[model samples]
Target: MKAPDFDYLRPETLAEAMDMLSRHGEDGAIIAGGQSLLPLLNFRLAGPERLIDIGRLAALKQIVDGDGFVEIGALVRHCDLASSEAVARAFPLLRQAVGHIAHPAVRHRGTIGGSLAMADPAAELGACCLALEAEMSLQSVRGQRWVRAVDFFAGIYETALAPDEILTAVRLPRRGPDSVQIFSEVARRRGDFAIAGLALVADNHMANPRLALLGVADRPILAEKTMALLANNMAAADQAIELIGNEIDPAEDPAYPPAYRRQLVRTLLRRTLMELLP
Candidate 1:
């Protein structure tokens, strides 16, 4: 299917893109790599009157290391993140998660900000962001604001972003020396959307770990209680599984039934915890 008629604008500057978005409001959609939006447009699931393409905005395509955080521009592609030495060194969870997203071709065109903004429940980036405790930099003609990952995703395909706002960057806190990271997911076939996935980042000594699950809920589900359970008694893996199953309300989908998904969560949680072992 071909996309409906729409006006396209490739703005060279961030201000220009913001102006176009403000003018078009809900009728306009932001296109980064077009990896996700183009398919939605072709399927007629999204019909926008205007498209604000920020793919050419070089200012939005950088990855920089801050004192305590790593900043990734919204336009940074998955392939870039996967290959980045800085990302590999400081954000192993993100690098590992990006390596599993779709495939090489898709990674070349998929942007980190686009995936998070889309808020797909089965996306690795969303789950990684939650586990990393990342923050997003949002901008609009009005002003700019930062949103924590915990507060950014409202539901599946839903976010805190307004129609005229754009996500410009994502900030991930650098893992400390004692941090251990793990990421695992199961799909029907390689490169397919996950049936279930898990990402875990913990400082065992500090007893603060972030446990997040995907493909088991409407949005990426942050399992604070499950993390606490694991931290308290890493020996009792069954307790972690039971806590996750009882806490997360997974949806029934064609890929897997709700019961199967709950079981997957348990299995993945156990495996991830095992990976955290010294």
Candidate 2:
């Protein structure tokens, strides 16, 4: 099936994109990478009246490093992030995580903004962002504001971004010298969406650890209880692993049952924690 009839608008500037979105409102859909949206359009699952192409907007493609954090433009594709030396130096976990996101061809076209905005809980980036406490930059014709990763995702295929708001950038704090970031997942096949995944950011197991799990619920979940356990007693990693079953509510997919997915989470979590060892 071909995409339904829609007016294609290519906006050259961020301001121009904002105005286009404001005019189209709910009827318009933003297409950055088109990795996710094009398939939906081809399947006839989504039929928007307008396609606002912001792919070429310079503001959304710029990656800037600040004193305390690194800001990635929303339009930055997976391949861009995976190949970024800056991203590797500052946040190696992200570079490692992006590798698990489909194949190279798909990565070349999939945008970080598209993935986060789509809010697929199974995707690696969302969990990584949650572990890093990345702040989402959103803008609209009215104004702009930052949303915490935890708050940005509301549910499956849903986000806090209003109809008029476009995700402009994602801000990730610099990894501390003592921090260790771990990312791993279990999937049926390589590059396929993981059945379960884990992203862990720990600073000597004393500071508050950031733990996020993917494909476990409606959205990426921060494992506060497990993190607390590890923080209080680093040796309690074993116990924290066991508590994941009780802590998260993973859905029952037809391919991977709920019990198996939870088990996969446990396996991935254990594997991730082992990385903390010398």
Task: Provide TM-scores for the models.
Answer: 0.96, 0.97
Error of 2 at 22 (Å): 0.7
Instruction: List, residue by residue over 61-139, the lDDT tens digit for candidate 1.
Output: 9999889999999999999999888888888888888878888999999999999999998999999999999999999
Quality of model 1 by C-alpha lDDT: 0.88
lDDT per residue as tens, model 2, 1-278: 88889999999999999999998969999999999999899999999999999999987997887889999999999999998888888888899899999999999999999999999889999999999999999999999999999999999999999999999999998878877888998888999888789998877654778889998899998988888888847688789888876688777678877888778777887888777666
Q: Model-by-model lDDT, in order?
A: 0.88, 0.89
Clashing pairs in 2: none
Tell me the deviation in Å of residue 186 in model 1.
0.7
RMSD in order of candidates? 1.3, 1.1
What residue runs in model 1 are displaced by over 4 Å at the alpha carbon?
none
Clashes of each: 0, 0
